[model samples]
Target: MNSEIIITKDFIEIGKLIKKIGLITTGGAIKVFLKNNIVKINNVTPQGRSTKVYPDDIIWINDDVYVVKREK
Candidate 1:
């Protein structure tokens, strides 16, 4: 299943976005994504909390790829 929502400047942090959208647990967000070794940013592993993720950015976690996009 797929869903979409507007990010209205409030969905800044990944952890917050994960919980705010009822996507997953904050702990799972940290363990699976925040680890960098598991998640990929722009096709490469990102190692930072301040990784400004704007619209159209593709985040890959395991076999699932979450495509970021501005609500238009």
Candidate 2:
């Protein structure tokens, strides 16, 4: 399966993306992911409050693939 984010605006924040995409229950979850230190942004565990997520980026937590895109 592939998820697409049609550039509706300039850029989307990772925390916002998680909520917008329904990956987490609340914005607090974004903190949990950060506190636990298990979320990777663009293939590396990110530790920033304002991490910008652009197009064609991967957001993975643990072994589950939260965000991904595949070419058909």
State which candidate has the highest TM-score: 2
Model 1 spans > 4 angstroms off: 1-6, 20-24, 27-33
Summing lDDT over every window of 10 consecutive residues in candidate 2, give the lowest-scoring window: 63-72
Which pairs in model 2 have colliding backbones? none
TM-score of 1: 0.58
Judge candidate 2 at residue 28 and give its lDDT: 73
Candidates in order: C-alpha RMSD to true structure: 3.7, 4.1
**What lDDT score goes with residue 2 in model 1?**
35
Give me the candidate number with maximum lDDT: 2
Candidate 2 lDDT, tens digit per residue, 1-72?
335644455567777876776667787778776777567777886656468776667777565555433333
Q: lDDT per residue, candidate 1, 1-72, as tens digits?
A: 334434666335555544555656663555454654456656876555455566666766566567666765
Question: What TM-score against the true fold does each predicted structure earn?
Answer: 0.58, 0.63
Report the alpha-carbon TM-score of model 2 versus the true structure: 0.63
